[model samples]
Target: MSERQVARATLVVGLLALTVLVVVLVPRDVVPGGPVTPAPVATVLSADEVERAETFSRWARTWSWSSLALSIVVACWFGLTARGRRLVERVPGPWWVQVPLAVAALVLLGRLVTLPCAVALQRLRLDSGLSRQAWTGFATDQLTTQGVAIVSTSVAVLVVVGSARRWPRAWPAVSGSLLAALVVLGSFAYPLLVEPALNDFEPLPDGPLRTQVLRLADEEGVHVDDVLVADASRRTTTLNAYVSGLGSTRRVVVYDNLLDSASRAETLSVVAHELAHARHRDVLTGTLLGAAGALAATGLLGLVLAAARRRGAPGPGEPGIVPLGLALVAVGSFLVLPLDNAVSRQLETRADVDAVRATGDPAPFVSLQRRLAVRSLADPTPPALSQLWFASHPGVLVRVAIADRVRAVPG
Candidate 1:
């Protein structure tokens, strides 16, 4: 063959390979598992279901976008408003004391601003039957979450600002290690300290389910002395399971609702998925990535604060920059959204794959995913931009297609 003909053939083959890669990565349709093409398009949702799902999706998107806007706006308002800055300064305390008090107030202010919309969102969930939580329980959870957030955030702010003031030129370097330690410490403490405040948990009673769970954990190479069950049925009817903590605290937790609602095969599939997360140390992986992101953020903060001070803005922990600092953090969060989601989606996709292989039956894997979406009122086709910025897991249809592809393969 001539050299030109050989080159053309190679190019054609390369294009075909690239096309296959795209097809493999994305599902061909909205149906769970894979395309039902050449068969008439299968209905995934009834008319009423579609209308309700759309309402839920619209409510969620509004809440998400509004929250983002409010965060930035609140930050800017505090940063610019002389009265707000003065209110923070009126509190008499040490820089440590002063910072915490101001931060607490600021946090409360943000919460108050967003609370109405939050309540509305909860009401929507309740009306849709997604949540079973009473208003009293909901209120208590909110107060608890706010209290925890204020305390943790105040400590973090102290650490960041103190490091900056103490080592102006090397603030990022000094704070990175401490912040990373805090991130890891927080991860380890969460199941013991924070989770119990929200929900009660107990060991899964001695039953066939427990036996199956332990067996799956063993097969997945994860140690599970006892699988714990959270009383999630009290707050939400959503079927779910998760793995949390590390070392001795490492355990698989399934919602009581999941056990009560899902079939034996479906339950096994969920357990296997959680075990995969623990076995692969996904939480630790996330914490490490979080630490890296903190370092980058701290570095950015240092550079910005330095520039601002040169232009006469207040130095660290001085109260004047408190609002600006919060605003900057909000912007940082917006900037990192894509990168964070990319990592999360990759991890979630792998866990889905692990669940399918561990179960060796893609049918339950596909069924469980569809059930979760239908139960949760998830958007059938979220916009691509939304997925890029916010989705932590692959779309349910994509996951189903993965199972379909796997089931098609001969052993």
Candidate 2:
């Protein structure tokens, strides 16, 4: 079969898999009864609070958008121009060594370009009382994040180049399947490998809160072996919790700040929400979707690179393709942001519904949402475009409305 035919087959299979998974796994009617009407911002937040959140959000969006645009520009400049190819060709090594080095160079360049925006955003968080991390700790975190990105990208590039070199015409099918499997493997490994690098985690102590959390998990039919507390207060003041990993590795992780500041009920509200995610295997669903996406992206990349080669660009196995491949990935990720976030919002909403039903009380849930928004200085009503593109969870008002709707349902 021709390379184009193979690529087309891979793309179609990936799309079909992704579509079927979304339809089968994603929840449609999570909230009970009619459409929910969000509570007015004024009802929950004071005038001063609303103003502060809005001002912070505006600056936050500016910096975040600037960083994204700058990164894309840097990637495109290095990927689409002769300069990037020349840089890669000048590097002293074989394809294996040169490809990894080229990927590192491109990633580092993009990170450096966007450093100013990152600093500005961090400063904003600090000033708003959202972040308590010192500059040294912040710098360390940045380096750690960049290191992970470089390592992951280098591995992926090596696989692509190696596959293309070994199986030219069939590289797309081979690489796509390999990467998709890697995506699933990475999801399972993340809790074990990546979580430890960022924070110190300790098992939640034997206490009433722990017992209540375990009881909640039991009631929800989630098999939670232990609850872990992260030393998040070392870096930030936000209250949050999440369930991470697949199967045996899965555990509930809560912020220490939350344990210290929030009441028992409020803490359970948060944990219950996370337990809902676990009960529904939302993380697994997300991982499967991501794997499908990687497969589809690989096929599309193969097609585009084949076309580019005919127009004098580098072939798939060449070191010169590294920058172009990275650029395409950056653009594709940005383009898909809205769809990803939309799915995330739906899952989050379903979790909220389950949490409310599990607890059979909406007062603490409502209060918890308000407290989180106020403490984080989250805009109660973010701009529609921002919510569409970037917001993973629903807006504060929307979450509160979900609780209210649940409460209003006849018993």
Candidate 3:
């Protein structure tokens, strides 16, 4: 096949494989119990909580948009401007060293310019009583996050540089596969490596809750060995649960606060939601999508770089051009936010559906959704534009509405 045809076929096969994985991982039997029944919805929070939630949502949008604008401005400066290109030229080193340095400098520069907005958001969370972490802890967390970004960006740049140096004509093919592999590796390794660095995890104690969780997992066809709990209360009051890792590292994790505060029914609803993700092997599905996305992105990057070269821009292997590549990736990623969030919202909504099916009721699911919003001060009705591009899950009111429609279980 010609290279173009070959690239197209490879992309199609990779995406199909990911779709197959997603299909194979989910429990086919998971469905609405006795067809969803309508139930009366009652208030789950006090007037004070509702007021705080509204106030939080109001200014939160302003800060969030401000932060987004600043980040994009910085990305454009580093990617499109002569000044950013000059910064890289000022650094003296070999290609490998220079590329990593450029990646680091750009990453650091982005962080510096956006730090004020990040701090402002954190302050909002703390003041709103959502976060309990101290300033020192928050600052340390930021540094740690930046460190990870630097390492990840540096590795990606190095891979591109090496691939280009050795296989100029075939770099797109090789780098695409490599990027996909990197995404898969990170998905599998994140829980084991990166997550442990952020919080302590231990197996949930043997109790009625644990027994119920294990039983539910078995009922759902998920092979969960244990449920782990994170001490998330140390940082935030946000209640959450998730399934992470592939193979041996895979497990369901719940926030300790989830257990501490939620009723058995509410907690079980959360566990059921997480179990749906595990049953479907959502992590692997995500990895496959990541790989496919990488392939598509690498192909576009090739086209973009070629166009730049036609206009006398430095080639990929030339010194100080890594910033240009990083810039391309950043802008491309930013542009795809709406698409990403759409997929995420779909997955999340599916999990919500599964939880209702697994539990045979929707009251707890609805109640938990309400409490989550109140606890986190999430915006119930964010700007539609922002929700389309940025929200990873449906608005709380929407979730409650979905639950309210579920068929009431026979009394």
Candidate 4:
């Protein structure tokens, strides 16, 4: 190739590199609007209750971090492979010619394969184990979150690729940085904004039975603002409950089917289980962990990209870099899925143990386990390998065994 051709090719490679960086690392997710505004009912909690809330927040943070770390690690690994690195080098083509080829490939792969797969997954209905009331809330939350992830990711990829091809080397960094920032902002925005909006639609609890549930939670040191009844039956027939929001807005949510279907003892057992999570402040704990993991993932990905760049990987106007980056993300998630689930399961087990201790009612807990098995139609004895590899929550048989032990204990 002529000298001019070689120079143009190298520049094109640089552009491709810039584009890949923006697409893979840029902050494109939605951002929470402004500061977290505590709700009106937040101040009624006692000092101990406030402490528990903080603990829950921390748990939530942890969960988020683990997922983030896994994603970054996988993404970076995919980005630095020989195929990806070779494309980043931009060997010898006119910059304009290379850009078109790269763009065409991106459109074909992303639109035809990646996007279609995501759409198919979204269309498939999964059973949500809850009453009709709780099921509605779960579906709403899941759909909202998944939609935001897909849209934001697509936008980030498009913006990065387009800008990298057009901009000069000196200016391309700006494109990459801006994309990265936007993604970060978006990630925080969606949850913070959507969570509050959903809270507004939250229905208030009625009837003496619900009131008693609230009273028990309170007596056991779970100072909740309101008990929100969700229609979770749409997702699955499983009995379940959760406590969410913060400050005065914090509420204990129970699925209606859980209350109706479970025996009185079983219902109390389930409530006690969820109440333990609330009292211990596991959500906050998970969130803190998640943030840490995300930061770590970002850092690891940057290192991988840097190493690839040193190998003369193609810049913008190249075909391989963008796909390679996305592939890395996919691989990383596959590896981390099991580990993240393990952490979550560990925390769940803790909540279960605490419930047994708190309620001192193993009979109800045992009953709760039986009902869970029947309603979810879960295998009473799932494979041990599956439990270790994929179980997010402990299996029914395992839970029942624990309850039985609790029952045998002398009060």
| Poorest 10 consecutive residues by lDDT, candidate 3 | 34-43
Candidate order by decreasing TM-score: 2, 3, 1, 4
Whichever of 1 and 2 has more lDDT, that candidate is 2
What is the C-alpha lDDT profile of model 3 across 1-411, one tens digit per residue?
A: 433444455456555655665456433422235223222223555667767777987777778778777777787777776777788898887788787788788888888888887888888988888899999989888888888888888888788668868877667677778988999899888998889888899999998999999999999999986689999999999999999988888899999999998999999999999898887677777777788788777766766776787777777667556767877887788898987777777677778777887899888998889889888887665678888989988778767755655544322
**At residue 149, what lDDT does model 3 achieve?**
87
Best by TM-score: 2
Q: Count the backbone clashes (under 3 Å) in each candidate.
A: 2, 0, 7, 85
Model 1 poorest 10 in a row by lDDT: 34-43
lDDT of 2 by residue, 1-411 (tens): 888888888888899999999999988877888657788988889999999999999999999999999999999898888878998998888999999899888888899999999999999999999999999999999999988999889988888889999999999899999999989989899989999999999999998989899989998899996799999999999999999999889999999999998888888999999999999999999999998998888899999999989988898989899989999999999999998998999999999988888888888888989999999999998888999999999888989889988888733
Candidate 4 residue lDDT tens string, 1-411: 432333344445444544554344322311122212222222233355445434433443344445444445444543656754455345346544443444344333333333333333233223222233343565566556555555555554455445556653422343445554554454445434654544332454576667667777877898866666665554456677776554454566777667678776666666777777678666544544443344334334334444566677654334455655466556665676776676667667667666776677766776666556555444433446655665788665556555555455533
Question: lDDT (CA) for every model shown?
Answer: 0.75, 0.91, 0.78, 0.52
Q: Worst 10-residue stretch by lDDT in candidate 4?
A: 29-38
> Where in model 2 is the C-alpha error above 4 Å?
none
RMSD of each: 10.0, 1.0, 3.5, 14.9
Which candidate number has the best lDDT? 2
Better of 2 and 4 by TM-score: 2
Report how far residue 61 has shifted in candidate 3, in Å.
Answer: 2.1
TM-score of each: 0.87, 0.99, 0.90, 0.57
